[model samples]
Target: MKTTLSKIVLLSLWAATTSLFADSHGDHDWKPLFNGKTLAGWGVVQGYANYYVEDGAILGRTAEGSPNTFLTTYEKYGDFELKFEVKVDEGLNSGVQIRSHSRDFGSRR
Candidate 1:
């Protein structure tokens, strides 16, 4: 009887661990936005600021006499989570825009 109970407990523990791993695997379906080589699906607008890829990172440098530059995605998303690492110089301000819109001059009819 003792051996039978021990076998049952071990089986239950194994099943629980398997289920935990399966659940964790199912939660991850992340897609990367940057390709780390180039800005394939991103765009910049309304400024002279420069953006480029170096050392496996997207780098942006502010240009003199330029308006506020924006690096935006081409695609639209309703809801999502974004994760990134940013390093900026001191006394400079940076931000990320979400669910933004641009005015269309041609639509004025």
Candidate 2:
């Protein structure tokens, strides 16, 4: 009877331990967008504005009421995971464009 109880306890403990990390995969290839020191593969639209890297993030500041400035990816992607950290300035008006299309000037108000 003692041997059976010991086997049951060991089996229960092993099952719990294995179930805790059952979904953990040892193979993953993670790619980062920013290189943390420079904007090597970034494209900027507004020529008058300035953009630089600060603390592993792309920083863009408007140059005296300039037009809309956007930082786009140099490579085009159809469907993939794109993750990044973004911080906006205080009281700043901005916009973000995702998988979208543009219309003609007269068609849009």
Candidate 3:
């Protein structure tokens, strides 16, 4: 009787743990926006810029003696919240514009 009860309890515990783990895995659904290989969906507005994929991140660098560079997403999003980390070199002249329209004549910031 004791052996049978212990086996049943162990089986029940294992089943519970497996169900919990499975449920946890099903709760997350995150989609990537960039394909990281080519600028298929992104739009380049102005300036001499270098864009490439490195370390699973989209990187844009302004070269020396280059004009102001702007990389804008091709897909225009409205009423949406986006969170990203912008790391600029110290004392680097960099500007980012979000939800702002550019000038058709000269690509104003």
| Candidate with maximal lDDT | 1
Per-model TM-score on C-alpha atoms: 0.61, 0.52, 0.54
Native-vs-model 1 lDDT? 0.52
Give the per-residue lDDT digits (tens) of candidate 3, residues 23-108: 33555433334654565666656665565555444555555565766666666554433443333334555444668765532333
Between prediction 2 and prediction 3, which has the larger TM-score?
A: 3
**Model 2, residue 72: C-alpha shift (Å):** 1.3
Which digits, one per residue and each the tens of the lDDT, describe model 2 over residues 22-81?
344655443444555776776666434566665544555555555655555465445434
The alpha-carbon lDDT assigned to residue 67 of candidate 3 equals: 72
* lDDT winner, 1 or 3: 1
Q: For model 1, where is the 10-residue window of minimal lDDT?
A: 2-11
- Candidate 1 vs. true structure, TM-score: 0.61
- Please give the lDDT score at residue 81 for candidate 3: 31
